[model samples]
Target: MPATSSTTEFSRTGNGSSSASTKDIEVQLQQLREDISALAKTVAAVGNEKATEVKGKAKRAAADATDASYQMVEAAKSQAVSLERDLERQIRANPIQSVAIAAGAGFLFALLSRR
Candidate 1:
């Protein structure tokens, strides 16, 4: 009878320890979930910060490209004006030869158009 009572007590103590262990495991699992959630938020914030920086860089690059394109267009216009002035000076210096060359070009165009 004494042994039976001792065995019963041991089983009761084991049940208590088992319940306590289960609670401890549950608490640990909850803590891990919270830690993971916090880490996810941190990652998202870093990603957003990086995205903003990239957007700023892209805007700056676009502005630079636009400025370069404008500069090229202005240079082309300046070159075209310079060439027109040179052509006018040449025509004025050799009016007779210019007219003869114009007549020859016109004859060639007429022959080509007939074909």
Candidate 2:
């Protein structure tokens, strides 16, 4: 008896399924790079917007401080004017008393000069 080896036909076509092609991997890598670039752009834009907002707020705060300073100055001027007017009114209403007070001061000065 002679032993013989036999070959079996598995398929007629050579087409087979694979995980992914090289071109598909390249496409996926390109998409990931694009997504990263887009995310970086978004973060930069948000940072710039926040900086602008802070700058505006600082400007407004400076303006408010300036306004408050002006208001305080105006109030001080008004108080000084009121004081001047009151002194003038007092002098006018008590002319005789004012003269008597001046005479007494003068007499005191003369006595001090003698000393």
Candidate 3:
């Protein structure tokens, strides 16, 4: 009867050591939850930083492409102006020869159009 009573009392109160262990488990669980929250916040901050970096890289790439196209257009305009000046100089140096060549081209064009 004494052993039965002791067992019943132990089961009801869960003994001093068991109760302390239970408290320790609860504390550990709470600490685990806080640690997980901190880790999630760290991950979000890193993601935001990466997103900002990618946006900056994209903007720089777009600006570089725009600058390259502008340079190409300027080069084309320069070349066209140079070609026009060269053609004028050639015509002025040999006006009679230029006139003869022009006449021959006109004759060939007229003949082709008739065909």
Candidate 4:
């Protein structure tokens, strides 16, 4: 073959190679875009799961606090009832003394208020 013919063949092959390389780059770019999209979706799902878990923990904490508060209120009510009963029993045992003490306290309160 002539030198010129060999040179032309080389030039044609080079052009075809460049075209194939460009097609390969385009395919790789499309695959990369797909991978990125899939990654984003995965990240979003994980984030949602974590958020749900945190929400559940918060709800459980709130319920526990409410139960504790309710128990405290019940305890306070029981204590108040016990105290009232004791006071009533003492007053009934010494009606005259209780009346005298109440009057003295009232007089002292009146004097303090006037000042």
Candidate 5:
């Protein structure tokens, strides 16, 4: 009787090494390519999400600035109206005194204009 040796179909060079199979190497390479593609998609998704978040923050800031500006303008207009009303009331209460003040101001303007 002769002794027998066991070998697998993928074990070439008679070394029982399945790692030498071209089919196995190609399969691993294909899996690596797929993993890289998935990683790229994930990175792109994260980038897009960050961009959207920043855009939203910028829009909110702009809206807040506009609201503040409108409030300030309204306040200035209210102050101007209040001052005008006070002046009108003063003129009405002392008509003769207002006339004297106006005459004095006119004389000063005339003197200054002569220069």
Candidate 6:
């Protein structure tokens, strides 16, 4: 009878230890979930910050490109006007020579077309 009682006591102690271990595991799992949730939030915040930075950079780059394009167009217009003035001066200085050159070019073109 004594031995049976001791065996029963041992069994009860084992059951208690098992229950305690299971409860500890549950608590650890819950803590892990909380930690993971915090980490996810941090990651999302960082991503948002980077996205905003990238958007600003893109906007600035686009503005710079637009300004550069406008400058190029203005420069081209200025060059064209300067060239036109130079051409007009040449034509005024030598109208006869220009007419002769055009006639010669037309004759050459006619000859080439015949060939």
How close is every model to the real structure, measured as TM-score? 0.83, 0.51, 0.65, 0.76, 0.59, 0.83
Off by over 4 Å in 6: 104-115
Per-residue lDDT of candidate 2, residues 8-43 (tens digit): 121212122223455677899999999999999999
lDDT of 1 at 22: 97
Which ranges of candidate 1 are over 4 A from the true structure?
Answer: 109-115
Q: Write the per-residue lDDT of candidate 4 for residues 1-115, one digit (tens) a residue.
A: 6999999999999999999999999999999999999999999999999999999999999999999999999999999999999999999999999999999999999999999
**RMSD after CA superposition, every candidate:** 2.1, 9.2, 4.0, 3.0, 6.1, 2.4
Between prediction 3 and prediction 6, the one with superior lDDT is 6
Q: How close is candidate 2 to the true structure, as a TM-score?
A: 0.51
Where does candidate 2 clash, by residue pair? none
Residue 88, model 1, lDDT: 94
Give candidate 5's TM-score.
0.59
Tens-place lDDT per residue, model 5, 1-115, is 1222334432444443445566678899999999999999999999999999999999999999999999999999999999999999999999999999999999999999999
Cα lDDT listed for each candidate: 0.99, 0.84, 0.97, 0.99, 0.88, 0.98
Which residue runs of candidate 5 sit more than 4 Å off their true CA positions? 1-26, 94-115
Minimum summed lDDT over a 10-residue window in model 4 is located at: 1-10
Pairs clashing within candidate 5: none
